[model samples]
Every structure is written in structure tokens, then in C-alpha cells.
Target: MQFIDLKTQYARIEPELKVRIQAVLEHGQFILGPEVQELEARLAEFVGVRHCIGMSSGTDALLAAMMALEIGRGDEVITTPFTFIATAETIALLGARPVFVDIDPVTYNLDPAKIEAAITGRTRAILPVSLYGQCADMDAINAIAARHRLPVIEDAAQSFGASYRGRRSCALSRIGCTSFFPAKPLGAYGDAGACFTDDDALAQALREIRNHGQDRRYHHLRLGLNARLDTLQAAILLAKMEIFPEEVESRARIGARYTELFQARGALGTDVGGAPVLTPYVHPHNLSVYAQYTLQVEDREAVAAKLGEQGIPTAVHYPIPVSEQPVFHGGLLGADYPVSAAVARRVLSLPMHPYLDEATQERIVAAVAKAAGL
Candidate 1:
């Protein structure tokens, strides 16, 4: 089974995808074309935000957001270490330090309780990741950011369609960024991303930043990067948006079904529940899109190998915490992330996609049960 099953999704949206792509080809405005504006508008409306600035990639979106906020050398950004490196890499790219914080073992997201303690005079922002399609505790994190008078950027690359307390993922913070890397829950055919915000000034700044800080033709307003999204990607994303809501529902259903199937075998447990496998624990207030239905399994290597033997594909969302990456070695001083460290060693992802049939899902789950020796 394909880990993400993008092929099935492509088939589902083939007609619309072709029409959109053809239109882009006919129009020949490959860069920031009309499709890009249309996509930004649709994304903004979907997220309940006032602005959505299309970008070249999720990494660029994060970089542009930080640039607009003026986070640079000598600054610090507090973030979780249990996520993909892009979350922290963008922070470091701006000549700023990424202050590592332990995650909430249950949700695998930034622990809000530890956020305040990490804030210092140099802390410019709080960057929280909505890992594995569920949102972080934005309300609690926002409260802390309010106290510190800092901006909060939700790295929502994995959670574009998720809901947190009735709000969408990309609408949950001062500046929310998400990827469209063909594998995200709501993705384009190629590299693309967007920055969402309610603040008009920040929105304007983000738009300019993505176009090399140009407010008017050739008039550089500030130092910026060429982070604009391609029109073709925007067209493809627009077509996918037509069925995104339904896909989100399917993802939620499939994720729940996976948990139920695993539990029926008495194989499911919490992060610290001592059972051989731990299922994802989403907060009641949030509706996860389940970008990946991950499990924390004992004897990870053996379980993966067993699954492989049965022709079942499994992946590791992350095997190394961002804080422990060689590039940042001896850098994030005084870091002691026991939770992220532990999760890194144990996490495994199963096949997850809206199109996964019930029969296929059962087979995959059974393989996992046997692999974990449940």
C-alpha cells in the first residue's frame, strides 16, 4: 500500500486538474497569475482569515512570515523539537536561534506549559507546529504569547484542513503557514504554500515579502525573498479545493476507524500506557485531518520489518528530534527533551489517505497488530 496514496487522489480530481492546468497553460502567466490570487482568496475564506499570501513553498512561507515580523539575528523563536526540521530551520535561516521546548507526549505537539519558561528578552515569537494533522493548543499558547506581546506562527504544514475550537488550522494564530507539497492533507501537484493572517498590515507585508519586498514595480520596500507561488500549482490546488472538505471528513473517519480496529485487538495504548502500541490521542476540542495515522510502537525496527514482509508500507514521521540534528549540535544550550527524544525512537506511521477502503484498512491494521505481536 502506498504510504499517502496520492495516485488515487489524482485520479479522483483528474478532470478538474486537467482543466485548471490547461487554463494556466493557455493564460501563460506562470508566476503570480490570476489563479494565484484566486487560490489565495479561496484559502483565506476557507481558513476564516482576511488574507492568504501564496508562497513558493511552506519553508518559504515560514521564512517570509518571520521576515515580516522582523525576527532576525540575536532573536529567539520558541518552538517544539519533535517536528520536521523545516519548523526550526526557517528560524535559524534568519540568523535567529530556535529555543527548543519539549512536546506534550499525548498530542505530540508543543507543550504550552513549557512555553512561558522558554521566553526571554530575546524571544521574538512562539512557533508551534500542528503535528500529524492535529492542531496544537493554540488557545493556551496564544494566552502566553499575549502575555509576552509576541506573535505566534502556527507551522500548520501537516494540518491545513484541521479544526481547533471551531476555527481552521491556518486561521488559529497571528501568522499561520501551511504546505502544499503534494502529500499534505490539502496539497497541490508541486511546491506551494500560503501564509494566513487577520491583520491587514501583516498581510500586506507578507504579500510584499513573497515578491522581493516590492510594493510597487521595482521599488524595494524591505529586504525580502522571491517566495511567490507558481500559478500552475495554485490552479491545481484550486481544483483540489473543490473536494477538500469531503476529503477532510474522510480522513477523520478513516483515522477513527484505524484506532477502533487497533483497539479491538487490544493493541492500542497511550504514549505511556505500556501497551506495545500507542495510538494517536487527539484533543476533544480539535478535529484532526489525520495527515498521518501514527503509532508509537515497541520494537519499532522489528515491527516495521514485519510489516514490510507482509507488503505493508510503514514510515517514520520523524526519527530524530530537530534539536538533536547535527547542524544544531551543542547549540540549543541546556536542552533536555526527554519526551521528543523518546517519541522519536518509537513513532511509526501507517498508510493514511481519504481513499483507503475498509477492506484494505483492515488488512493494514491486522498486519500492524501482528507486527507489534499484539
Candidate 2:
């Protein structure tokens, strides 16, 4: 079975996708086209935000948000080390330091309690990643940011359709960024992402930042990068967005089924143990899109190898903590973020998508159970 079943999704939306792309081609307004604006508006409305600035990629979206907040040159952005490198890379790219925080062992998201301890004089923003399509504790994180008067940027790359409490993931923070990478919950055909915020000034700043800091044509207001989203990608995303809510619901159903199946077998117990495979922990106030149906498995390498032998694809979302990566080696290794380190070793992502079939899922579960020697 395909890991994400993008082919099936494309088949389902083929007619609409073709129509959208045809319109973009017919218009011949590729750069900052009408479709781009339409997508931004629709996305903003979906996320309950006042503005959405589409960008070249998720990385650029994060960079644009940071630039808007003036988070650079000795500034520190607090985040978890369990996420993809882009979370910390964007901060370091701006000459700012990424203060690593340990994750909540269960959620694999930045621990809210540990965030305050990481803040220092240079702390400019708290960038919490909504890892594995589940939002981090935004309420607590926002409260801490409020106390410190710092901006919070939600790295909602994996959590576009996810919800925290009654609010959407991208609308929960000062500025939220999400990827349209093909693997994300809500994906475009190619590289694209958007930044969302209610603050008008920050919204304008982000727009300028995405267009080389230009307030208008030939008017350079600040140094920035060319991070405009392509018209084709925008059109494709607009089509995808039409069915995104349904897909999210489908994913949650699949996730719940997987939880039930695994929980039936003691092999998927929550606590760490000899035959335990821990299902992802979703916070009570949060709804996960299950971008990846990850589980904490002991002897992860062995389990993966065995699954591979059985023609069942399994992957580790992260094998090494970001703090231990070679890029950050010899620089920011002072703290012992035990939870991040521990989760990095055990976390394994199973094939998950809205279109994942029941037969395929059953086969996968059987393979994993056999691999765990259950």
C-alpha cells in the first residue's frame, strides 16, 4: 500500500483540480495571480484569521513570520527539539538562537511548563510546533507568552485542519504558519505555505516580507526574500481545500480505529514496557488530523526492519532529537531535554492518510503485532 495514497486523493479530485489549473493557465497571471488571493482569503476564513499571506514554502512562511516580528540578531525563539529541523532552522537562519525545550512525553509537543525556564532576556518569540498533526498546548503556551509579552508562532505545518479547544490551529497564536507540502494534512500539488494573523500591522509586514520587503512595486520597505506562492499551487490548494474538512474527519476516524485495534492488543499499551506500542496521545481539547499515525515502540529499528521485510512501510518521524543533530552540535547542547531525547528514540510513524483502506490497515496492524512478537 502507498504510504499516503496521494494517487487516490488526486483521482477523487481530478476533475476539480484540472478545472482549477486550467483557469490559472487561461488567466496567464502566474505571479501573485487572482487564484493566489482567493486561496489566501479562503484559508484565512477557514482558520478564523483576519489575514493569510501565502508564501513560497513552509520554511519561507516561518521566516516571513519571524521577519514580521523582528526576531533576529541575538533574539531567541523557544521551541521543541522533537520537530523537523525547519522549526529551529528558520530561527537560526535569521541569526537568532533556537532555545530547545523538552517535549511532553505523551504528546511529543513542547512542554508548556518547561517553556518559562527557557526564556531569557533575548527571547523574542515562542515557536511551538504542532507535531504529528496534534496541536501543542496553545492555551498554556499563549498564557506564558502573555506573561512575558512575547509573540507565539504556531508551526502548524502538520496541523492545518487540527483544532485546539474551539479554535483552529493556525488561529490560536500571534502568528501561525502551515506547510502545503504534499505530505501535510492539507497539501498543494507543490511547495506552498501560508502565514496567518489577526494583527493588521503584522499581516502587512508579512506580505511585504514575502515580496522582498516591497510595500508596492519598486518600493523596498525592508530587506526580505522573494517568497510568493505560485499561482498553480494556489489553484491546486484551493481545489484541495474544498474537501479538506472531509479528509480531516476521515483521518480522525482512521486514527480512532487504529487506536482501538492497537489497544485491543496489549502490544499497544500506553505505558513503556516489553511489548508496548504506545498510540499517539491526543490532548482532550485538541483534535488531531493524524498526518502520521505514530506510535512509541521499543526496539524501533528492529520493528521497522521486520515491517519492511513484511512489505509494510514504517518510518521514524525523527530518529534523532534536533538538539543532537550535527548542525547544532558543539553549540546548544547545554540542557538535557530528556523527553525529546527519549521520544526521538522510540517514535515510529505508520502509514496514515484519509484514504488508507481497512484491509491495508489490518495488514499493517498484523505486521506490527507480529514484529513486536505479540
Candidate 3:
């Protein structure tokens, strides 16, 4: 069984995908092509934002957003440590410090309560990651940023179609960056990303930054990186968007089934009424796209091994926290983020996708319960 079932998704859109790619080929506008602009416009409209700048990759999108905001040397950006390294890597790349914040144990997102304590005079931005297809608490984060006159960049790589308080993920902050990697909820065929914002001036800066800081032909306005999105990827995304809304609904239906099945076991004593395995928490005010159906199991290794034995694939979203990474852990001790450290040792991800069928999910869930010896 495939972990993400990309093959099924590909088959569903194969005809459209072929036509879109062929169109790009026929036009021969590979870079900054008509498709790119069209895609940016569509993405902006979808996110309820004024502008969307297509980028080379998710990492480039983050880098370009930070560059557009001019976050560099001696500046600090507060973020959670229990996420992919790219969230913090881009900050350090610009010679800025990534101030680590502990995650909300329930949401696995940056805890807003700890954010104000981390902010200081050097703080330039607050980068909150919307992990596992759910939007972070952007309202609180934005209030803090507003008080400090700092920008808020939502790392929305895992959450494209997610919504928070009726607002879309990429439209919830000063600048929201999302990925088009194949596994993301809304993805392209290859590497691609986008930066969304309501500010026109910042959008202009980002457009220039993606094209090597060009304000005009051969005019270098600032130091920048080549981060343009390929026209082919844009075309693929435009096709995918046609079915993206229903796909998100499918994910929610499947996710709800998984939650019900796991909660019915009633073996785990941690949550009083829930099962032993702790399923993901989607706030009442938000909608998650179920990028991954993750569980916090006491014996993660045992559960994963058992799933493998049953021919069910399982993965670990993250086994190490970003704060513990060697490149950035110079002064941070392992105990600093106690929650991140403990959560890292227990998280496991099961096969999740919009096409997942109920019978297959039941089989997978039964395998997990048996694996845990429940």
C-alpha cells in the first residue's frame, strides 16, 4: 500500500495534467510565463489575498519572504522547534537567530503564550508553522506581532486548503508561504511554492526578489535569489485546483472516520474517554486538510513495526526537533524544549490521502490497535 497514494491521484488527473504540460510546451514560455501569472492570480483569489508570488520551492518561498521583509543579521524570529528544519533553516541562512518556542501540546504548533516572552528588541518577525494541515493560532500571533511592529509569516507548506476562523491558511498573516511539493494537500507535479500577502509594496518587492531583485531590465535593486516558479508546475497546479476543493472534503471525511475508529477502542487512559493513541486535534474554529493522520503512541516503534508486518505503511513525521539539530543547537540544551523533546519520541504517521477507502482504513486501524497490544 502506498503511504500517500499519489498514483491514484495522478490517474484521476492524468488527462488534464497531460494537456496542461503540452500547453506549456507549445507556448515555450518556461519562465515568468503566462501560466505563472495565471497561477499566482488564482492562488491569490483562493487565499483571499491581494497578491501571490510563485516561487522555485517552499524553502525559496520562505527565504524570499524573509528577504522581502529585510530580516537579517542580529534579527530574531520566534518559531516552534517541533517542525521541519526548513522553518528555522531559512532564518539562520540570512544570519538571523531563530528563537525557539515550545509547542502547544494539543496542536503541536507554536504556543502563543510563550511567544511574547521570546520577543525582544531584535525580534523582526514571528514565523508560525501550520503543521499537519491545520492553521496555527494566527489571530493571537498577529496581535503580538502588531504590538511589536513585527511581521508574521505563516509557514503553510502542509496546509494549503486549511481554514482558521473562516479565513484561508495563506491569507492569515502578513505573508503566508505554502509548498507545492507532491505530498502537500494542494501540490504541483514538481518543486513549486508561493508567497501570499495583502500589501502591494511587499508583493512588488517579492516579485523582484524572485527574479534576482530586478526592478527593470538589468537593474539590480537589492540582493536577491533566483526563485521563480516553473511555468509547467503552474500549469499542473491550475489543473489540480479544479478538483482540489472536493479532495479536501474527502480528506476530512476519511480523517473523521479514522478518529472515530481509534477513539472507539477505549484502551488508552490518557484522555479519560479517548483511546490509547492520541489522534490529531483540529480546533473547532479551524478545518484541517489531514495532510497526515498522525498519532501519539506510547510505543511508537512497536506500533510501526506491527503495521509493517501487516503490510500497512506508517511513517514518522519528525523524529528530531529542529532546536536539537547540530547546526543550530550551539547554546540550546535538550531540556529547553521539554515538550518538543518528549513529543518527538512518540509521534507516528499512518497512510493518509483523499482517496483512502473506509475498509482499508479499518484494516489499518485494527493493525495499529493490535500492534500496540491494546
RMSD of 3: 1.9
Q: Is candidate 1 or candidate 2 better by lDDT?
A: 1
Q: Which residue runs of candidate 2 sit more than 4 Å off their true CA positions?
A: 270-277
For model 3, how does the per-residue alpha-carbon lDDT over 283-319 read when each residue is reduced to its tens digit? Answer: 8898999898888888788889888988999888799
User: Least lDDT summed over 10 consecutive residues: which range in candidate 3?
Assistant: 268-277
In candidate 1, position 308 carries an lDDT of 91
Residue 291 miss distance in model 2 (angstroms): 1.0
Clash pairs, candidate 1, are none
lDDT of 2 by residue, 122-223 (tens): 999999999999999999999999999999999999999999997998999999999999989988878999999999999999999999999999999999
**What are the lDDT scores of the predictions, listed in order?**
0.92, 0.90, 0.89
Whole-model lDDT, model 2? 0.90
Candidate 2 vs candidate 3: the TM-score winner is 2
Scored by lDDT, the top model is: 1
